[model samples]
Every structure is written in C-alpha cells, then in structure tokens.
Target: MGDSVTSRALALLGAFDGENRSLCLTELARRAGIPLATAHRLVGELHRWGALAREPGGDYVIGRRIWQLGLLAPVQSGLTQAASPFLHDLYGTTLATVHLAVRDGLEVLYVERLAGHVSVPVVSRVGSRLPMHATGVGKVLLAYAPEEVRLEVLQNLTRITAYTVTQPARLLDQLRRVRAEGYATTGEEMSLGACSVAVPVRNGETVVAALGMVVPDLRRQLPRLVSALQVAAHGISRTLAGPASVEWK
Candidate 1:
C-alpha cells in the first residue's frame, strides 16, 4: 500500500505541533517528508478549505475554522458545559487555583481553570498539556488510566522540578496510593511554591476527567481541600450523568 492523497495532506497537517505552530512551505515539506511540489499543492488545497492560513510572513498556521470546529467537539462542549457550574462553585468555596482536566494519551490536558487573585502562581492554562508525573490532576488521571498508558508514562517520567517524581518505581507506588485514597496530591512537583490536590470526575462508571486545585501549600489544609474538591467533583459527575444520576437530595 502507498500513501494516499488524504494521507499526504494529513501528514502535512500533522507536521505542526505544540512547538512548531507555523511553517513555511519548505519547512512543511521537509517535516511532512513530502516533495516540495506535492506539499505546495496540498497546502494550497488545505488553505482553500480553511484548514490552514498564511500569515503576512508567508508561514502557514492553523486557521480559525479549526478552532471553531474544535469547540464543537463533544469533549470540549459537553464536558465544559456540565462542569462549568461546579467549577465556579469550587473556585468560590476555595479561592484557590481550580482546574478541570482530562487525559490525552500520556499527558494531562487542562480544559478549564479558575484562579483567585492571591492563589499560587501555576504554569498551566486552558488547553495546555503537562507531564503526568508533575501535576495532581495528571496523577489522578494516570492512576486510573489504561495499563498501556500507565506503563508508557512510568517509563518516560521527566523531572519538571526538584520535587517531581523521576523514579518510575516511586511513581508506581504513588499511583497505587492515589487509587487507594480516591485522590492525588503533589507538593511543588510542577513548580516551586505550588502544591496541589485532585480527585477523579466520573461519568457513571468511567472516570472522564479530573478536578483539582493548586495552593501555596497543602500541609495544613489537605483535608478541607479534599472534601471541597470531592463535593464539587460529585456535582460535576451528576451533571454529566444526565437523567440517570442518583438522587442524593
């Protein structure tokens, strides 16, 4: 079998990533491993279809249409809608840096966040992807992730800070504890002076996402934080459960 026109087009698009967001024709061809003429033809087609846009400097970037389509994705629209109220409540209750995240392969993808003016400075943002071993929400997602994904992350643990878990054996133990305790916590693992705690958000039996909060410290307030997060997570879960949600009133 040979690469089809569709595959070639997709390869050109796939050549762009979190770092290489913009590329000239030559760079696109080189990265996509296609000939210059073929790249130019496919790029023109994608540009006409609103999949790629050319900047003033003549570099191609993802177009506005892609952003519009991404918003229509169920993971973005449905989850955000169901969790918005609970996220607001959690932020009001804790006045901390609140986050909503889901697993994307071996990384954690933050979908929503709310932060108070005085909350700890965190490095994450909506749509940002972070290492699974360096974040509380990531740990929660990793703890319950598929076995293949778990092993992949364990084998590739990278140190993000002095406190980040670099040892796969230790990280395996921590994941076990997260499963046992129903939550995960990290102290300055992603960044200095930031500590976090997280719990799983469920859509029925499957864990769909993780809810978390970043604080200056968790030593004196872990218990209260965990309780509040669980409450909000429960609310979000019920919202996602739709008409079949259990009645707790």
Candidate 2:
C-alpha cells in the first residue's frame, strides 16, 4: 500500500534523533524520504500543532508538545513515577544530583533527574541520551546489556573527557567489575570535576534501569553513595514488580 498522511508526518518527526536534534527543511525532507513540498506542508502542520518548533536560526527541532506527549508513554511514565520519590529521597540525603536511566540501544536514556545545589558539572538532562561507556549509569547499563550491544559500543568508545575509557580491553574490565560488584563508578570520565556511582535497578531477575548519583568526588564517600543508590534501586524494583505497577517497556 502507498504511504499514508499519518505515516509521512510521522517520518518527518522520526528524522530527529539523539544526534540530529535540529535540521533545516531540506535536510528534514531528505531524511524523511519525502518531497520537499510535502515536507514543507507537513512541517507547517506539525509546527502549528506544537509538535515542532523553529530555532532562532530557522532550523526545526522537536517541540515541547512532543515531550509532553512522551511523558505520557507507558515506558517513561511508569519508570519515572516508580523512581521519583526514591530519587528525591536520595538527593535529599546526599545533596547530590540523582539520575534514573535505562538502556536505549547502545546509549543510556535519562528518564528522571534531581539536580542538587552542589556545583558538580552534570551535562545530562531528563530526556538526554548519552554514550554507554563514559558515564556511571551508562557503564551499569552497558555491563548488563546483551553481548552484541556491548561489542558494538566497544568498537567506538569516543572519548568525551581525558579520563574516558576508550580502550576496549580496559572498558571490558570495568564492565566485569560493574557486574561483579553490583555497582559502577566513573571518575571525571564524562565531565571534569565530577564523579558518579550507580547501581542497577532490577525488576524480578532482569535489570530494567540504573540509579545513579553525580558528585564532586567519590573518593571518601563511594561506599556510602553506592549503598544509598542500591537502596533506592531496590525500592523502585519492588514498585515495578508490584501488581499496581504500570508498564515500563
């Protein structure tokens, strides 16, 4: 069957991903595999409906409406709701930035974040997807990921900071430790002057997400932070496994 209007419009929105967050009209049309004129018309409708927004440079980006709609999805809403109170409690106790993330292909998708008043340099936002080899939560997710996914990520460990583990063998060792120790830690790997510790959040026997915290340093308080993260993760896991839990996938 020929493509429908809904499919064509959906294609235009799907053209924007983690890497291609902004695109010109021509680029969007090409990526969506539609005629420029069709794209122009669909783009106008999307922009009018607040599904797309124009940047100051005239490029198009995903708009707030999409985000608002995304928040209603079962996966995001279920996981975030289950983890929200625990995240806030962890932040209150540690006074550090807390993050709840899930593995999305070869990256870690931040589902929720509680920003602390601490001056640590954290670049991740609630909806941001980051590499699976640099951040603490990323390492935890990667450690638990399927072997093929891990192999692909190992091939391109693009260094974000001087401390990022670009060497596949070294990263392999870290993943092993993450699995054995039941937690993961990163030292200035994703950003300078920031360290993180994360624990896996398991639903039944499977790990569904990662719970993490970003701080100025993990030297003196690594154990404490890991303990706290694990506690919150366990709480979330319990909630997810309960009968009243919402669908996370």
TM-score, predicted candidate 2 vs. hidden true structure: 0.83
Give the per-residue lDDT digits (tens) of candidate 2, residues 93-204: 9999899999998899988899956558899987789998999999999999999999999999998999999999999999999999999999999999989999999989
Local distance difference test scores for all models: 0.91, 0.92
Mind sharing the TM-score for model 1? 0.86
TM-scores of the candidates are 0.86, 0.83
lDDT of 1 by residue, 42-154 (tens): 99999999999999999999988888998888777788888888889888888899999999988999999998776687999888899989999999999999999999988
Q: Where does candidate 1 stray beyond 4 Å?
A: 116-119, 244-249
Measured with C-alpha atoms, the lDDT of residue 177 in candidate 1 is 99
Q: Single out the weakest 10-residue window by summed lDDT for candidate 1.
A: 240-249
